[model samples]
Target: MEPTTLRAVMAALRKPETGCPWDLKQDHQSLARYLREEAAEVLEALAALRPGDPATEAHLCEELGDLWLQVAFHAQLAADRGAWDIHDVERAIVQKLVRRHPHVFAEVDVEGADEVLTNWAAIKREEKGQAADHEPRLLDGIPASLSPMDEALEIGRRCAKVGFEWPDLEGVLDKVKEEVGELQAESDPVRVEEEFGDVLFSLMQWARKKGVDPDAALRRQMIRFKGRFASVEDDARAAGGWEQRDLDQMEEAWQAAKRKGKA
Candidate 1:
């Protein structure tokens, strides 16, 4: 049978006997890495977007579709096991959104975005069966699957909500410096690794305090570095390849690329 819809297509691909062999071999755990990869590609496509560039827009659209396929694939896997399917996934999100947004769906009043967020958190806790007077654990709801940097930022944000954070930007800056100092003083490899993690976590908190998305900042920096390094590689190729060019020559090329603002 010809699959007409996205969900139908996924179901067709996962169908036994006539289905794709590779698709039949995959499970939720096996598809996890592809999900992460598709999401990262979507982010990259978003970063490459320009105001009126149709090519970049198309690229973003394609990447988003790829990410959506991961969702559909997982939903198909669940369906194969006699669990919920794609429509259930869609309905669940719709129900959750309507339930969470009382300010829009109900008569609840909110002053601003912040108040809306506050109300949303309260509603989420209530939905989780947490009492209004209950003091939840510090990192109760934070997902363990989050990247370390994101986990650090969440930890800082959660603590800040309960008045545990530093008073000002200066205090965060001092903490960053202190963590860096501790990292620098570490000699043992294990201790060094631990201190380095502390420094990174401290920097993540600092970035949160400064209203910066650390992941986006790091991605942009990596893009810029790649651009500059490409120039250095070009210079090396022009001078008879990498074997002929020294670190100083590469550094000069990198500096020139930086001066030209390659990214």
Candidate 2:
């Protein structure tokens, strides 16, 4: 079905007389976890995509539908409460996009991507009234609830826009090394935690400078580790279970697993 039809179906699902009981019971707060989960699943689906892969495209399409359902669900809840609905959601996004992309919709002349970004930031700041509101700090616009790595990257980007950034990638790399050394030198629990966070933040800056997404890099590493660890588990079971194996023996199995790429 089309999006509007699906949205109407979602609205019908919350009707008092004939709606699904579970759907009728969900409030915005209760639906938050589902929304987050669906979004993560959408990302996972997109990450699996390869060029010219129909199966991956289908998977992504389905995952996007699930994500859209969360949007419809939330919009339905608001409509029931006499606030807004799916049409309002669509209209607001359309308006915002046109307003934000003057280079596309209007006569704004942007020489390159960097100029476009600079103009976008200026337009956004004006719309937000960061100056008139006396909240001039660029980082103030970043959401506090963002994951630390993402938050760090955003903070770094905003800082760079204002000339508060390192001269080059080498400077960022040096900062990463410095942060690591500081983390290694720290001993107190609180100090250690602070230093460790700095290390991660500095590493994020380095990753940004190198055109690598810190989150994606970490996720790829985690998947690799999971595969290798699963292989080690199988090897341990073959040798009569993990309880019988020592760290040295497990490490050997893990190394072999990494080499063989067996999960």
Candidate 3:
């Protein structure tokens, strides 16, 4: 977020007579979806970044600016509603960084990176609420609307922190197999849906054990799927065969595109 460009954007949005009608119409609830979409786009752009790829790097930089616009827009809205301003937000962030990272800012007992992380988690738990003994249940902090796979991984992580977890990936893999069998045995759509969810949860657990981000991996595959499908569409158009295309033909193109996509 360039300070001058950000200031101009804020000013434009807040301008009484000339402000954007759409921007003026949006409330927090309506803008939330855009925030999520923009964030996902920024993540996708970052993933595209590579060494010596100036064009991709430039795209990432541009997408980051777009991502920042969403943040600044939300900050402006909050300021307008008397909740908080961007300056207060920055101040709070700086204050928290100084407060939590006592290793750098003050004398705190941190022997290693792991200890520092443990200290940060300890501080966060204390800030959340002092129920150190009871253990905030594995599912406590995650939002319901979080992607189900990510939600499961977070639940697994929190539970693992409190000793309520499998000792190894084999256990999670076994659960995945069990969930798959349950999915196979189901006839009812509702039961199938339930079993499918269990499968996703179990796989997320395995991903957690493997130290892989299920959300990010899924996003990467989704991007590949989108790109391959677009290529397949172009292939069809190039062949002058649009309406006549069926699943078999699409599948052929999909297989070709996927091979290239993976490469």
Candidate 4:
């Protein structure tokens, strides 16, 4: 009687005769939301982590395990259908890593991280049967699951690699201003939406050129806003309720919080 491992536990949970009803009923499509949710929880846990804090470390570990469960569950479902299993998934990634990292696994020499990345892309293209002489598709290798901001950043990077980009940060900033002007001038709802998207895309390019991660910047801003807003909420509660507070009072509270270094 050995202790059951994660794979074995997943298999038991999906067993037809004795498995939990909810576990037995799940399929890949139905489990997709959980996969996304678990990944988001892992990100939140990572954001909450503090140096030398065991509680935060434990929280991150738990969230990561929840994310891993989604992978194991999917593998179990595939195994039940006689397609593949967890080991197949693990082995495929291991093989791909070794195949891609020629600098470590083979005799290929790279001077720096940039050269390593360039070599990795070349190797990846070769593996995908993209011939060296063939004109590569602009967005062929970008993952479809990337967020729109991330996708825009990748698109900008790919285009820049082939000398199809603004020459300087000022050029990108000018493009951003142009896009904003177009967005502000649009009146029709459909056209406004399109123009707004263009503005966001241009801003993403600007962020890329500025060496800023838009997602991380947004997350940090939101965290600051949350803390400031919590101060406003406390003020509202002290004054009776939200109904008793006005926008100016809320602004004062927010400014106080900002002065207190919440921002």
Candidate 5:
């Protein structure tokens, strides 16, 4: 469907007297989870897409439509509240992109992507009123809503940009080890929790330095675990029941599953 058609459809659903009762009742807070779900579905669709596949392209297009619907829904909600509309959202992003990309839109020169990113960050700081500060925070604007692993990655990247990172990958690994040792030595639960978080944070930084996405890595591991565990359960069901299996038996089943390339 065309963009204008979709916007009209959403507007009809949001009509006061003749609209969907559920859609009419939804506020931004209530619709928040749908937005997150749609975004994740888009990611899943992209990850499942194979290069040069027309079917994958259709799947991605459908997923993107769902994601875009969330944006339109939010825009409608804001418009109903007299805050802003879809056009305002579109206009703001257009203005922000043109303002931020001096090298592309204006006379500024940049050598490569790194320089472009540096200039972009500087422009962002200026826009946020932090450029003139003497002692600006490294982790400013890192969203609290992000998962701990992602937040750690963002914090590490921000700090690294300001030369506050470890001397080498080995130094980061050593910090992880040191954090683990402190965690082992701690007897207090609160201190142990803090130290445990430090260990994960250090490992997250190490992963970032090594050009790995910690969130995606962990997600893949979890998927592997699911496959391997399902194989183990299949074996147990074939024998008798999972409750009848000892730890050694389960380990054997797990190893057999791994050997079968389930993981």
Candidate 6:
């Protein structure tokens, strides 16, 4: 649909006399979470889109509608505040899209997708005034509120950009090993804690260098661990009881459950 028509539709939805009460009541802060949820739903639907999957299409439509709802709701809020209406929002984004894509809209030369990426990066760097060496710059861009694992990845990427990175995956592996050795040698509680954290951080850095999302990778492992441990608990309860088993016995059972996950 056209931007003008979409704005009209949103205006109707937030009309004081006959609009959606829920939408009218929402603010930016209130609708912030819905954006994330709808984005995840969109991603989920896309992931499940395959041959002969009617449900996936249905899910995709619903997710898109949810996302649209957030956009309209926010536009309404902005209109109410007299800051900018939905038209301004649409116009701003349209302008930004044309401005960013010089390759398509302008006579700018490009070789391939790589050239486009270089142009895009150069545009962004020019906008942000990024340094030539990229020294301590990406770190400056990463939000302080980002999750710890995500911060590790961001910091690792920043360092990698400056060439303070492992030469290869083997070096990362060695770094992890070194941290582990330090962890084992430390006896002071504080020192041990720091060493163990160093190991985890090194592992996260290694994952980044290997093109792995350490957070998602660890979350996958955590899900598997939870599933297997729950199974062990169930097995122990059915056999006799977990309380009846000693620490070593329970540990053995847990290990067996982990092996079952590998199968």
How do all models score by TM-score? 0.88, 0.87, 0.80, 0.87, 0.84, 0.68
Evaluated against the true structure, the overall lDDT of model 4 is 0.89
Locate the minimum summed-lDDT window of 10 residues in model 2.
132-141
Question: Candidate 2 lDDT, tens digit per residue, 1-263?
Answer: 43358877887789898889999989989999998899878877766665589998999899999999999898999899999999999999999889989989998888988898887777877887767357566667688768778898998888887789999999999998999999999999999999998888888888987899877677667777888899889988998998989999999988998888744
Q: Which ten residues in a row have the lowest lDDT in candidate 6?
A: 42-51
Order of models, best TM-score first: 1, 2, 4, 5, 3, 6
1-263 per-residue lDDT for model 1 (tens digits):
57789998988888899899999999999999999999889878877776589998899899999999999999999999999999999999999999999989999989988788788888888898988788478788789888888889999988887789999999999998999999899899999999988888889988999999888777778888998999999999999989999989889999999999944
Which clashing pairs does model 4 show?
none
Q: If both were scored by lDDT, which would come out higher, candidate 2 or candidate 6? A: 2
Full-model lDDT, candidate 1: 0.90
Model 6 lDDT tens row, 101-203: 8989998989987677668767867667877686344557688757688788878876775589989999999999999999999999999999999998999
Off by over 4 Å in 2: 1-4, 47-57, 129-135
Candidate 4 lDDT over residue span 1-263, tens digit each: 54279999988888889888999999999999999899878877766677689998999899999999999999999999999999999999999999989889999888988787788888888887888888467778689888888899999998887789999999999998999999899999999999999999999999999998788677767877898899999999999999999899999999999999733
Residue pairs clashing in model 5 are none
Cα lDDT of model 3 by residue, 1-263, tens digit: 53366856785786668788888887778888988998888877766667579998899889888888887888888877889977888899999998789999998777987678788888887877767787665577698877767677778877776689888788889989999999999999999999998898888889989988776677778878889999889878987877768889999999999898668
> For each candidate, what is the lDDT?
0.90, 0.85, 0.82, 0.89, 0.86, 0.79
Any runs in candidate 4 off by more than 4 Å, and if so which?
1-4, 181-191
Error of 5 at 49 (Å): 6.0
Which candidate number maximizes TM-score?
1
**Which lDDT tens digits does candidate 5 get at residues 102-199?**
99999999999878889988898788777456536666667888877778888888888778989899999999999999999999999999999999
Clashes of 4: 0
By lDDT, is 2 or 4 better?
4
Q: After superposition, which runs of candidate 5 have C-alpha atoms over 4 Å from their true positions?
A: 1-4, 40-63, 129-131, 134-136
The RMSD (Cα, Å) of candidate 1 is: 2.4
Clashing pairs in 2: none
> Could you arrange the candidates by lDDT from highest to lowest?
1, 4, 5, 2, 3, 6
